[model samples]
Target: MAPTIPGFGYRRVPVADDVALNVAVAGSGSPIVLLHGFPQTHLMWRHVAADLAADHTVICPDLRGYGASDKPSETDGTAYAKRTMAADIIALAHALGHERFALAGHDRGALVAIRAALDHPEAITHLASLDVLPTLDMWDVMHGTGAAVGFHLYLMAQPPGLPEQMIHATADAFFGHFLDVWTNNPQAIPAEIRAAYLSASRAAVPSIVADYRASAGIDVEHDRADRDAGNQLRMPVTVLQQDWGAALGFDAAALWNAWAPGLRHTTVSCGHFMAEEAPADVVKAIRDLLARC
Candidate 1:
């Protein structure tokens, strides 16, 4: 079973006729939707979501394929695109009686929130993107040694067949690599929760592959089209990320400033999984962003 926050209740929320998100909801104020990253489900937000619930209705959902959510076998890759995933989030909040809400995404989910802020600007009251760059910028920054970290980005970007076969061949190790390396504090994810993530990710090999593959192809295309058009995030935007650019030789804040004027970008001292690694900071950053809106 997926880990749960004390007061939250589970719901299978229908975003479309064939797709429904397994969501956890709690509290009863302005709604704020939290999206999880790769190799994880909404369960990643256990602490942060629970904290936010004190003053906000927090909705954490498995992004269509990672947990007990619907995982369609189709692989055109467009279905897993951030644009489509963003729509799922918007539709989910609407279904739960939220017309305009704060949206936060960590890792893969950050990409979706970025898309949501770009595509449906009016619907998002505030936006918090944790530990990621835009798709185009992400690809643009990786070069030579800098590109070494994104081995999986190139791996899954290849046309489907092989990536799925290889990962499925040894799913736990593949998923566990991130859980192992991405966190500075092993205590952030205890034994049982890590097991849950590993199990869910192993079962979600296909959709996870398709989701990353979309980033390499369609997600980049969507991002380029926006950058070319001079689109910017209209809402109050806060980006909390590890200073990857410092180590990787790029200006993370400058790249984000190009897309988000007056952006509240900060270099967090934590591992890649900020929500879990630094839940208090993540919660405060999100709360601060919403207060601005």
Candidate 2:
């Protein structure tokens, strides 16, 4: 079981279209919104958020289509676009009375946070992205055997109902494979947290697939537009990622540098689930980034 941390409580807040999000909020200082990656919920930040909450007001929310949040039907594919999801975060923050705040996201959340910073630069003070390349870079770089590593991305990006149906057909194996493979430290995610992730992912299959599909389509277009317009994140940015170049034959830092001019990039020894696998190191990185900001 995931060890319980005290002082954390869940709240349901309204975002767009009267959709309510079940967010886990804790601590009592300047606000920091935490976003989770694909196939995971706010629970991914259970360790890091609790630690940050000791000194900062931390708000970890399940993104619109994930976790305990409202899984609204994907209307016109724009619904799951990071632009809309980022807006949801901005609205969620505003609802909590924070006109401006720091933001950090892991996996898919990292993408959403970056989108928020680019689209709503005036609303974010500092930004941190964990373990993801910008959408355009990601799409441009995938090729041959290197591309095979992210097979799920391609599979999930396929049209409509198929990806969801395929994944749901083998839901446990689909989600469990990542839970077992993505972490450097398997024990980092306890039984309860693992079970929670599996349950939430199984429940949000269609919405989750819609999210990845958006990345392959509209999200890529948005990223290209931003690159063409020379739009980069204005806030101080920190990116912590596993060095994919050493194994995957790409310059990870160079790609991030193209998007974030004021960027601090660090490679951690942990696998994809850095926050859970290496909480102390992740916490220190956040503190160092916050200090610089």
Candidate 3:
């Protein structure tokens, strides 16, 4: 049997005419949606989600084009854009009877959360982002040899054919690389969960690449437009991130502050996979974020 969050019930909900997200939901209070990041599934939130479910209606979903979710072909460039993905999230929340909810996401999911907050401000009562900067700041801060850390970003950002083929050929190594390098405590993920992440990622190569490609193109364009318009995240916002600013030559908080006037930024010592390696801290941060709202 596939791994699942303990005590959570699973279902598939239609977000668009052709798209449905695989969602794991539990608890029964004010809803809070948790979106999983790249190269993984909703299972990444097993630890945190279980904790939050004690007092909140915790909803964990594999974003479109990921995990067990539907992977629509990128027939048009807009198919995998964060804007489109964000809409799917909003629709999912509505379909689940949540007119508004608190939202949190890690890594690639953080990008989607950012877009959702910007596009549907009223639907997100509070927002938390884990370990990632907004798309515009991300591109701006990456420069020189330091940027080498994100070779995968550049690889998938390439136009179509080559990236998909290259990654597909060595899917395990490519996906496994992040799982291996991004966690401080290997046991936090366990042998089975790591295998599941690799298997899911290996099966979704093309759609995953399309997601990254959109970030490099349409996602950037949307962020730039929002910045130009002086639009900010109107909800109470919290950000937990590793201290990438010191090493990357930029202020992570300042970048987030530009987009979120009501913001609390924290620097954590954990690795990229903080949700798994430091789940208790992740839970505390989220609970504090909800308190603020």
> Which candidate has the highest lDDT of all?
3
Give one digit per residue, the lDDT tens place, for model 2 in 74-186.
87989999999999999999999999999999989999999999999999999999999999999998998889889999999988878888999999899999888888888
Candidate lDDT scores, in order, read 0.90, 0.90, 0.93
Question: In model 3, what lDDT does residue 222 have?
Answer: 99
- Structural similarity to truth (TM-score) of each candidate: 0.98, 0.97, 0.99
Please state the error at residue 46 of candidate 1 in Å: 0.9
Q: Which has the higher lDDT value, candidate number 1 or candidate number 3? A: 3
Candidate 1, residues 1-293, lDDT tens digits: the string is 55676789998999976999999999989999999997788888999998999988999999977888998775566788989989999999999998999999999999999999999998998989999999999999999887988899999888879999999998999999989988999999888889989999999988888899999889999999999999999789999999778899999999999999859998789999888888989988888888894
Error of 3 at 206 (Å): 0.4
Clashing pairs in 2: 37-108
Over 4 Å off, model 3 = none
Candidate 1 global CA lDDT score: 0.90
lDDT of 2: 0.90
Selected candidate, larger lDDT, 2 vs 3: 3
Worst 10 residues of 3 by lDDT: 242-251
Q: Against the correct fold, how does model 1 do in TM-score?
A: 0.98
